[model samples]
Target: MYYSTDYSSPIGEILIVSDGEAIVGLWFYAQKYFMAGIDDTVPDDDLPIFKKVKKFLDDYFNGLNPRIDFRLEPKGSEFRKKVWKILMEIPYGETLTYGEIASKISSKMSAQAVGGAVGHNPISILIPCHRVVGTNGKLTGYAAGLDKKKELLKIEKILS
Candidate 1:
């Protein structure tokens, strides 16, 4: 079974999903691919994971880089997981180009491929996919929309 809750964030309303024990997804309301591949969830505002995620987000938006220790079980293939792992390594107030992520993973992987994986990241802010940018440092390819992406980066002080 799946549990779900909503968080009112500075950027917008967010829908957080959990598989009882670990968070599986967190999407901005109406985001592109919102809740993609998720199914049969019940409202569960009291899930411990949701509360922890809320606190994590609260700290992040409040200009604190709180250590993230909550369990996450985002569903995806090996390649996507690899990309998401690199995304997690991006510092709280830093950004990386899609090509940079591709080169880190494999010389054979193209920036387009990395961008595709980043675009599909289910955990959003927690995974830090919003930190990926164009090679020239222009923001791009956020499933939650670029404006929201900019807001998140700005909150992190990555964008002035």
Candidate 2:
């Protein structure tokens, strides 16, 4: 079952979702889907993975490179999973464009396809989709909202 909890952060409120075992999503408060079709109730349990996600997020907000050790099952196609795995290789405090990621993963893949996979990332921060930017080094699409994207980039010290 999917459980959710609300957390207040420096950037904004966040909705944390877990499958009772692993956190599945971490969405910003301003996201339209944050309040849509989601059970906002969290069960009273010793959710270790959920707690880890919260802690990682807290450390990230505190300007620390959070050591997150949690399993994630991001729902997507094989190509999408390949893209997300490449995204994970992008070290923290660094940025890459879609074309760069595509080249790193497979020279045959197109930048537009890479961007599409990045946009479809369901696990958000865990997969580090925010690390991808426009080829021109400009901020680009983020499902949680562009403002939150900019905040994440800034917090990770990847943005000016």
TM-score of each: 0.97, 0.86
Q: How large is the C-alpha RMSD of every model relative to the true structure?
A: 0.8, 2.5
Point out the worst 10-residue segment of candidate 2 by lDDT: 31-40
lDDT of 1 by residue, 52-89 (tens): 99999999889899988789888999999999999999
Predicted structure 1: lDDT: 0.91
Could you tell me the lDDT of residue 103 within candidate 2? 90
- The superposed Cα distance between candidate 2 and the true structure at residue 103, in angstroms, equals 1.5
Query: How badly does each model clash, as a count of residue pairs?
Result: 0, 0
| Error of model 2, residue 37, in angstroms | 10
Positional deviation of 87 in candidate 2, in angstroms? 1.3
Alpha carbon lDDT of each predicted model: 0.91, 0.79
